[model samples]
Target chain A: MTNSTSIPIKLQDRSATEEFVQKFDTFLFDCDGVLWLGSHLLPLVVETLEYLKSLGKQLLFVTNNSTKSRSQYVKKFAGFGIEVTEDQIFTSGYASALYVRDFLKLTPGQDRVWIFGENGIKEELNIMGFDTSGGNDPRLDEPFDVATSPFLKDGLDDQVKCVIAGLDTKINYHRLAITLQYLRKPEVHFVATNIDSTFPQKGLILPGAGSAINSLSYASDRTPEACGKPNLNMLNAIVKAKGLDRSKCCMVGDRLNTDIKFGETGGLGGTLLVLTGIETEERALDNTHGNPSPKYYTSKLGNLYEFTH
Target chain B: MTNSTSIPIKLQDRSATEEFVQKFDTFLFDCDGVLWLGSHLLPLVVETLEYLKSLGKQLLFVTNNSTKSRSQYVKKFAGFGIEVTEDQIFTSGYASALYVRDFLKLTPGQDRVWIFGENGIKEELNIMGFDTSGGNDPRLDEPFDVATSPFLKDGLDDQVKCVIAGLDTKINYHRLAITLQYLRKPEVHFVATNIDSTFPQKGLILPGAGSAINSLSYASDRTPEACGKPNLNMLNAIVKAKGLDRSKCCMVGDRLNTDIKFGETGGLGGTLLVLTGIETEERALDNTHGNPSPKYYTSKLGNLYEFTH
Candidate 1:
C-alpha cells in the first residue's frame, strides 16, 4: 500500500512530476469545493490540470456529489482548464447506478428510476444504459416495477428499489422516513456516495455526502455499500480504464478525506495532500481520524512541478 | 350511549324507532374500511341512519383510521343518507389535528407540515386554519427539511413541530429515514392515525398505516401519540362533543381490535361486539386477546337491541 509520507523527492518541475506520472500509469483527483463551487473555478486550477497532462499522467477526477450531471462537472472542469470527456470522469452516482443495476440484474434501459439528487448522477445512470424516466415526479412514487433512484416523494406510500443517497438539498426528517422504510426491507440495498462529512470549498469547510451516509447507515441498521473513493469499485474502475495495476497508481487529493485516504486504503503508489484543501497534519493529529494518517502533506500548490524536485 | 348490537326497534319502524332513539344521546363509528375504501361507500348504510335520526338521537362515529377528513366523511356519508354536514361527523383525523394544534401550540397556518397520509386528512388540517402549505411532499419520501417542516420554513434546525401520519402514497424508505431523523429530536411530535395493522378491503386484508407507524416508532425509539379510536383522545373527543356520561355510552362495533378493546382501557362505556366485520365470538372466547373480555358479545348487528330490551 502507498503512504502519503513516502512521496519521493525526485519529483520536481513538470518533467520530474512527468517521470513519476510515467512511473505510475493512473492518476485520480477529488471533487467538490475542490474543483469549483457551483459555477466558479478556483485559482491556478487550469494550470494544475495542464501541467499534469503535459508530463504524461493518466488523470481521473472523482466526485461523490451525484446531484449534478457528469457533463455539468465536465463543463465546470473545462472552465478551470481541465479538459475532459464524460468517460474520463467517475462519480459516486455512476458507481451507485451500476451497483443497483448489477445487483438486481435489471436489464439495462428496462427499469424506471426515481431520482432525488443531481442530473450528473442521472446522466451517468443513462450512460450505464439504465432507464431513468421517472424524473422523481410524485405522481409516480408507488410500488412500481423497479425504481433505480430514491428521490424524495410527496407522501408515505411510494415504492422504491434502492436509496442512492448522493447529495440532496438537506438530510431532513421526511427523507429519513423514506430511507429508513426501505432500509428495513432486508432485501433492499442501501448505497451512499461517500462517507465524507465535509469537503473543501474555495478553501472553506462545507458538509459533504457523508452526512446522508451516516444517517442512513444508523437509521436503516444497514451499513451502506459505498461506491465512491477509498473503495474497491472506483479503484478497480480506474485500473481497468487505464489498464494499470492498482498497487502502482497514485491517487492525488488535497484533502485527507479523499485524496490521501484513497492513496493509503486503495493501495495506490502514494498520497499527496495539498494544503489547498481539507485537513492539515496538525488537525489530523488533533482528531486522529482515519486509523492511519496521510503519507505526505504539502502546505499549498504553488506548482506541482516543485514537488518533483 | 348507543349499542352496536341492534337497530333501535323504534328507529326500525316509526313509533318503535322513536322509543329506541330515546335510549341513547350519542353515537361513534370507526374509520378505515368502515367509512370508505379509498373513495367508495358501503351498501345500505344510509337507510339505517335516517331510521335512527327519525327517532331523534345524537350520533358520533369514532374511528381508529385518522386519515380521513370529517368534512370528507361528511360528504361521503351524505351519499348514504339525507343532509349530513361536517360538524355532525367525528374522525380521529380531526381529533389528532386538534390535539397536535392545541397541545403543541402549533400554529397550523404558520407551520410547515411533513404529511404522511390522505387528502381527507390534509383537507381537515386546512379547515383548522393550519398553514395548509405542505412541508415535504411525503410522496417523494425524501424530506426537504430534515427536522422542521418546510411548510413553516422556520429555518431553525429544530423547528419541525410534528410529523402527521395519515394515508400517504409515497411512503417509502426515504420517508421512513426522514421521519426517524426528526423523531429523535425531543421537540418534534410523532403523531399517527391508528395502530391498525390490516385494513379491511372488500373481503381480503391489506396492510394499513400501522405498518408505517410501527416502522418509524421502532427505529426512532419514540412512541408516537396515537390519535385514533380506542385511544384516550378519541374517547375524550366523544365526551367533549356529546356531553354524554362516559358511564352511560356503550361502544358497539363489529371489530374487537379497536372498539371492543377500548372499553377495557380507554374510559368509555363497556363494549359490545357484533359479528359483521372484524371479530367473531369464537375467537374472542378462544383467547380474549387481553386479560379482560368485552362486556358483551353477540352473533351480529342489532343483537344489542335485543340485549338492551
Candidate 2:
C-alpha cells in the first residue's frame, strides 16, 4: 500500500516495488470496490495516491465497470477529492472497444446493433467506427443485428451478431431476456467486460459486474470473451500508451480474484492483496494452492507507513 | 413420473420415482440436486410413473442421499408427492439408534454406535447400547471420549458420543482435518451406514454418509450426523413391513440433484433420479440448460430400453 511515487522511503519500511525503483514503473489500480464502492472512495486511498504521486510514480485508474464513460470517472475523482484527467482513467468498456476495433474487423457497411450498456461502453463501440446507433431503448428501435446481454431477452432467433455484457441495473431483467433471445442464435458472439464475481468492500464482499456476466452466460450457455483485466485487450492498450516492457508494470488492488487473478490470469507481475479492502485473511489462506500467492498480503496501507517512517 | 400407489393418475412427468419403483420398490432417495435442481423437477416424469403403474403399481422404492432421518422427510412430504407409510423407505444417514429411540422417544434401550462421519454427527450419550468393543481406527475401533477434526491430532476433551463419517479422503483438507481429529476423542460413539455426495455426477459436491458427512458438512461446514440409509435406523428397516399406499405414493427425481434434492435435501417427497434409472427430465434440462437439454426427457423407462416392443 506504500504510495511508491511520493512518500519518501525511510531507512525502515520500503515495499519491494520501492526498493527496486526501476523494476516496476506503471501501477494499475482497480477502481470500484477497491478505491471506491458505488459512489464514494475509501478512506486513506487519497493519501495513498498522493503519497505515490509525491514519489513521481506513474498511475492509471483502471476499472471494469462499463456503466460510466471516462468523463464520468474524472467527475467521480473530483467528488473523491482527487483531480484526474480522462486520459488517466481506463475501463474494461474502453478495452472492449479496442478489442473490437483491432480484432473484430469491419467490412465498411455491416448489420446494425442495439446496445444496452451505459454510454461508456456504447461510446467505445461507436468510437471503433461501427455502425451501432439505434437509440438506447431497444423496443422503440428497428430490429437490430445484434444485442448484448446485461439487457436483452433470451431465446430470440438468430440475427444477433454478438451478445455483449457489462454492468447493468438490477431491474434490467427484461433487457436480459431480450439479450438471451438474440444470443441464442448460433452466429452471436458473447462478450463480457470481465469476470470478477465478488467485488470487495469494507470487510464484506459484494456482487460485481461478473454477477451480470454470470446470468448472461447461464441464460445463453455461451462463454464470454473477457476484455478486461487478465485479458490481452487491456494489456495491449497499456503497452501502446506507455510503451513500457511488461515486466516494468505491476497491479495493486484489494481483492484477490480481480486484482490478484489479473496478474496471473494475464501473465502480469507482482500482485498485492491489501487486507484493508475486500479479501479476508481466511480467504487468502484458502487459496494457497495457486502459484504467486499475492506477492504480498499486507493488512493495510498504514502498515507500509512503518516501512517508510 | 407416475405414482404407482393409490390415485394412480399421472399429474405430470416430473419425478423419477416411477423408474425407481420399476427397479427397486424399497428405494432410498437422496435429496438435493436430485428431485429439483435449483427449484424445479426433471420434465415429463409424472406420466412415466402413472404409465408404468397403470400396467400395475409394483414394489415402490425411495431413499435419500442425506444425513437427516426418515421421519424428518415423512413430515416434509405432506403435499409434494403421494401420501404413504411413514416407513415407506424414506431415509437418511443420521438414523442412529439413539436418534431413533432416545431422540424420538420411540425405543427403550441402551444405544451402540458405529461411525463413518464425525463424532458431532453421530453421537448419543446412552448407557444401553454403546459399542464398547474398541481397538483402532479411532473412527471405527478406539477409546475416545469424543471425536473431532483430524486437525486436533491429539486427544478429545468432550465426552464420547459416536464415531461416524467413514474414511473421507476430502478430510485431508481443512474440513475433513477437523472431523478426523474429532474421532480420536475418548468415550464417544462411532456409527455410519452410507456416505453419498449431494451431487454424484461431477463437481465433487458434498456427500451423505461414508466420509462425506464428516468431512464435507462436519469438517468443511454443515456439521453432519451419520446413520445407515435403508437401515433399521431409519425407514429402511420399517418400509417393507408398512404396506405402502403406493397408489398415494409418488416419487420424484432428477437423479443427481433434483431426485436427490427431493429424496434427501430435506424435501417432502419420495424421490430419486434415474438415467431412466434415477432422474427426471426437467431437472436435467435446468441443470444442463442453454447447453444440451436432457435426452429421454420423457423420463419414461424408454431411456434404458435400447430394444423395446
Candidate 3:
C-alpha cells in the first residue's frame, strides 16, 4: 500500500561496504542479472563472492529459473570459473521439490506429481525420490484431441497427488488438460515454481513460468502455491536446509519485485538491490511498482569488490 | 445480479408449442447438442428442422465452434442429410472474419492480421479479403524461442494491425508470443471468436476457445473483444447481414450461458432452452449461473414436433 520511493543508502564508501558486509553471515544471490546475463558473467561477481567466502559467509545461489537442475547450475557456475557445489544452488525446480517433499509432507513412494516443465523439475523431483509424469515426454510433444483422444477417456493416471507447473517450452493442450484434471480434484495440490510473467534474454523479454502457470490457473480457476522467490517458500526451504538464523541472512539481486520483495516478506536480515538488470535506479526510486525497498543499493554487484580489497 | 430461479414455461401442451412456434419467424439454432452431438444427429432434429421449414421459418445455424469454416459446417450439415448453404451457417470463424473486415474495418493489403487459430480462421479471413499470418502455419506449429529466435528480433511484420485468436488445435507458445507481441502495440486490435471456457463432447467437457484466449490475455494483460455467442457480436453480425427485425428472430440452444444469454443480450424475440447439452434442466432452472432464463423450455428439439403434428 505504501507508494513512497525512498532512496536506499548507496554503498559508495569502502567503510560503508565493509560495514554492510559485516551484518550478514549468509548471502543469497539471484543468478541471472546479478551474477551473469545470458552466457556472460558480470564483472567483479567472482571476486565479490570469493571475498564473501573469505569472510566465512554462507553463500547460496538462488534462481527463479526452473530450466536447469542443481548440478547443471553447478556446471554453469564452474563454466564461469566460480567453484560451486550442487548444495549451494537453489532453483525454483529444487525449491518446488523441497516444498512437495518437506512442506507438503507428501511421501515419495506413495504420492506422485504431474509436472508441466522440462528436465529441471524432473531431475529435482527424481532426486527427492518422487514419482512424476508429463514432463518432457515425447509422447506429449504433439497435439492431442481433447474430445476424441483415447487419452482423455481414461489415460490420466489417478495417482497424481500434485501438479508442479513451470516454464515448459513443449507446453500444449494435452499437458494443460491433464493438469486441469488434477487441479479440479479438491485433494490434489497445485504448486507453481514462479510467476514471473516474462524473463529477459539478450535484452528481449519473453514469456516466463508465470505465463504458462497463468494459463493453467485461468483454465482451472485455481491458484497454485508458488515455491519461488517473493513467495517466501523458497527462502524458507533454504533456511530449513541450512539451519541458518533468518536475522543474519540477506538477499542480493537486481530485480526489486522478486528479489527485494522476497527478502522483505521472507524475513531476511536485509535486501541489496543491484542496477545490473531489468530495473533502472530511477524506476526503482519511483516506488509505483509497490515492491519492497532494498536496505542498500549499488550500481552493480562489482561495487562490492571494494569491500574485499 | 439477479439470482432468482424462475421456472421457464415448459412447452408440453400442443397449444403451447404452437404458440412458441408462432412467436418467431426466423429461428437461430445452436448446432452441437441441439441438432447433433459430434457426428451423430440427435433425436427428432432432422424432423424438427423440416417442421420449422414447413412453417416457413428462416433457419440459421449459429455455432460458437471456431475450428471449421462456413463451408465446412455446410458439409457437416450435408453429412447429416440436412441441407444447408454457406450463408445459412454462421460459425465463430465466419463471425470473426466479418468482425475484422466490417466491424474493426481493418483494410485489406494495408493492415494485416496475426491469427492464433487454424485453417478455419485463415480461410474465413481470406474470404473477407484480409491478409493473415500465423494460423496453422507448420513453421509456427512448434514452440519457438521468443527471446533468442531471430524472428523476435525483427521477424514480425509491422503492418499487422490486429490479432484474431480462436480454437486452435495446434496452438503453441510461438503463436501466442506473436499474438502478445502485436497486442503490446496500442494500435493493434485484439479479438477472440468466443470465450466458451469449455465445450462438451461425448459427455466430457474439454477446454474451449476461451482457454487459448485466456492464456494470451493473461500474458498480454489485454482482454480481447470476443465475437462469438453470448457476446452478441455474432448475432448482431447475422442481423445486420440479413436485415432482420430483432423482434421476429428467436434463439434456440441447450446452454443457458452462451445460447440463452446471447438471445437475451442480443435483442432476440425469445430464447428456447433444450436439455441435450452442457446444462441440465435442474441447472437451467436453478438460475445461480446468472444467465438469462430462456422463455421456453423443452426436453429436446423433439418436443416441438407435437405442434407440427
Winning candidate number (DockQ): 3
Q: What's the lDDT for residue B38 in model 3?
A: 80
- Stretches off by above 4 angstroms in model 1 are A1-30, A42-59, A67-72, A100-103, A106-133, A136-309, B1-28, B47-59, B62-69, B82-93, B106-309
Of candidate 2 chain B, the 10-residue stretch with the lowest lDDT total is B3-12
Q: How close is every model to the real structure, measured as TM-score? A: 0.51, 0.50, 0.90
Give Cα-based local distance difference scores for all models: 0.58, 0.48, 0.83
In terms of docking quality, model 3 is medium
Residue B128, candidate 1: Cα error in Å is 6.3
Stretches of model 2 off by over 4 angstroms after superposition = A1-23, A106-120, A127-158, A169-178, A215-221, A264-270, A280-291, A296-309, B1-309
Q: How would the docking of model 1 be graded?
A: incorrect
Task: Provide the lowest-lDDT 10-residue window in model 1 chain B.
Answer: B4-13
* Candidate 3 displacement at residue B252 in angstroms: 2.5
Model 2 lDDT tens row, A251-301? 766666567667655555555666656566666556453423465555555
Off by over 4 Å in 3: A1-5, A9-19, A146-150, A153-155, A306-309, B1-5, B11-16, B146-150, B306-309
Candidates, ranked, TM-score = 3, 1, 2
Q: Candidate 2 lDDT, tens digit per residue, B1-309?
A: 332122222223334333434543433333444333322343433333344545565434344433334454554443446344454434443345435454533323343333333332233323333442121234432211222333134543343354444433212123223334444343443344444322332221222233234222322223344454423344433333555443334344434432333333332234433443333444454543222222223333333222121
Error of 1 at B258 (Å): 9.4
Where is the poorest 10-residue window by lDDT in model 2 chain A? A3-12
Q: lDDT tens digits, residues A28-97, model 3?
A: 9999989988787899989999988999999999999998999999999999999999889999999999
Residue lDDT tens for model 1, A1-309: 554344334233566555545666566777654455545665556666676677676777877767767778777666766689988877788777777776555556554444545466678777777665333445344442112224333332334555567665433434444455556567555677666655543323334566445545554546877887766776776676767777666666666656666677777776655555655547544434544455544454435644443
Predicted structure 2: lDDT: 0.48
